[model samples]
Target: MTVSHLFMQNYTGPLMIALQYNDLFDLDSISTSTDTDALPNGRAFTFIKAVQTVNERLVEQNKSDCLLFEVILISKECSEEIKMKVDESVKHYGLEIGKFFFCKKEELINTLQSNKVKLFLSTERDDVYEALHTGIPAALLYDQADDHVLNQLKVIFSGDVIGFSEDSLDGLSEFGFSETQIETIKTAKICMKEFAVLIGQMRRRFGQENSPLCTCVLTSWGSRNVCASALKTLREWGLDVDEAFCLAGAPCSPILAVVKPHILWDGGLLNMS
Candidate 1:
């Protein structure tokens, strides 16, 4: 007998946060203790309080990793005013601005389709329409803003990443985290049996957009060696190294397609080769 799947089975419960090329960036680890040094940073006014609460719960219950920059789509040339506002909000919420890459509109149209990029808060509604027509998830940044492409950012802050989209007011949804809040459960890949169980669960929780569970392998690999090789490769590709990271972790599995993921990484030049 064919079992019909439920309509909201994918996101009916708790939501997940992850990325596609997850290993490329290090996820945030938010500590919400009122006594923690970072608590002051999150005091900035934003709707990220619910996410903060969720992170607190994760730290208490399952030690889940927090997000850094969940990748926001925006104009490369956003206004200074809007940029300051968004930037302050991010810092107030204890979020970091890892890096920004600029893509020309025409170039984007050619590349975005293959990349399966979601249409973002942008100044060009026509481009937004084009992106949406391609079956990508696109949306206007906000209600009022300049119509120019380079002058307006229509900032889409990563803190706006929501775990649940339920009924809301003030244009924000209530966070759905509850006693059943999802957390990253630790499972060792040391043994075949343990490994199989971990993989099975990854399959089950893999596709949902808001799935909170994430898996990563920890290894004793030399950071200097790996980072040096990476620097060489990138430089060889004609890219200058403004910053480098020797992150320690195994290659992680990609997240589901529906929920586009963003990454945040450190800055500074590295000569650890």
Candidate 2:
């Protein structure tokens, strides 16, 4: 069955709000006034209100269709309370929803394909590319002047990291993120580029050997593009690698290919002894 999935690209603020406050207090809890400090961050609370408004709009627009909303809850606030709140929110709004959480790199791509997600609420350009390349329509969830990658996507509303694109990764002097996010992206990009190079080198070395391990990476479902790009660079470098292969029914699509040769070793880098 060909299912067209629609995912909301999560804005960090609203997502954080949904996790922190919603998990702690729901309509029932809030109605009962049991938790006064339920919402710790005022900004997150405001963002939640805005998100609810958007959800209401979605309900109004698709009144007749069976709306299945898939939310990728990739935040630091992954607690039982957050989970309950996310589930409750969807149920309360009457939306059929599938939710996944990520704190690692291997699950990003897997989730995208499994969901068959057509639209996104996450503004991460790399994540957007993961969806786009896999045939999903992605958009920014909020607005910001600093999001250069918005041009690369069908940007909806925008704010914070949800506004950034690959282009936003460049020109750190003028990037919108605070020093912390900028540093985080900078470190991650460096690691990503380095990982790509390492994989490429490994492929080359494996091709020269007759007894290479038939190995496959169980990559993160949500971060498939970064891994894919790294693998692609490996292929381009003339390494015969069986690409990162995922299990059947897994969210991550596994790439199975034979490794090629002609990869030059630099300073005995390929020797694992």
**lDDT measured at residue 142 in model 1 versus the true structure, 0 to 100:** 24
Task: Estimate every model's Cα lDDT from 0 to 1.
Answer: 0.27, 0.32
Candidate achieving the largest TM-score: 2
lDDT of 2 by residue, 107-127 (tens): 655554554443343434455
Residue 45 error for model 2, in Å? 7.5
- TM-scores of the models, in the order given: 0.27, 0.29
Model 2 regions more than 4 Å off? 1-36, 39-64, 67-103, 144-273
List of clashing residue pairs for candidate 1: 15-210, 16-210, 16-211, 16-212, 71-262
lDDT over C-alpha atoms for residue 186 of model 1: 7
What is candidate 1's lDDT per residue for 27-89, written digit by digit as tens?
A: 122223232222222111121222333344345544543321124323333345433444444
